[model samples]
Target: MAGVAMQLFISHRVASTDVAMAFMIQSMAFVCFNKVSTAQYFVWYLSWVPLVLPQLVKHSGRQENKGLITAAIAWPFGLAHWLAWAYLLEFQGYPVHLFVWGAGIVFFAINVWCITCLLVRVSSS
Candidate 1:
């Protein structure tokens, strides 16, 4: 798939952890935008998160760099919001397709913002 191709290409071009993390974030975004996404799909990228946690925490420790900290927290919060909407639509049989779609779009935006923050930190460091 395209994600695999992207990973392979990125791996060949750069051997930095920042690039690896970027690839994982991009893969996660791809799954988020897919027509059908399941909880398990998240594992593919989530597994890589811990590897970068130290880097993220290090950057976020600076009080002036509020964006990194906010992004770190917001990413998961955005996921939870999307999951709540999805759960309502899937389990409660609510006519909330609009809400689900809206949540998904918002989540995608959050992902973009988070990735931007990550890349900025990576470039600066």
Candidate 2:
């Protein structure tokens, strides 16, 4: 049901902004439905991140200035995902643990911030 809604949201094609926003919304939604989620679940959205990266840069219009700041946000988001997955692999045989939970929350927040930046750009434009 949630996945379908996300797909429907993505189906709209008014602009590149719409695609980027839809991707972000769907990514955040992935975290919403699951009570217990692994880092693997985020793989779907991580793929979309690169696709939206340029959108952020282009919209911001400050690659020389905000470029590093944008990258600063992005690198940690990616690292957090990697760490979450690493935790997942180290205990593949075991059930979901507290470590992933903590990482999940942290990463989710970072993703939300990333999405928020895109969203703000969209609204401002």
The candidate maximizing lDDT is: 1
* TM-score attained by model 1: 0.71
lDDT of 2 by residue, 58-99 (tens): 646553435336744674666567476666757575565665
lDDT agreement of model 2 with the native: 0.58
List pairs with backbone clashes in candidate 2. Answer: none
Tens-digit lDDT string for candidate 1 (1-125):
86567556545533465766666666665675577866688788878777877766674546436786787688788889999999999999999999988988888888777756665666566
TM-score of 2: 0.51
On TM-score, the candidate that comes out on top is: 1
Query: What 10-residue stretch in candidate 1 is worst by lDDT?
Result: 6-15
| Alpha-carbon runs more than 4 Å astray in model 2 | 1-17, 62-104
Q: What lDDT does the true structure give each of the candidates?
A: 0.72, 0.58
List TM-scores for all candidates, in order.
0.71, 0.51
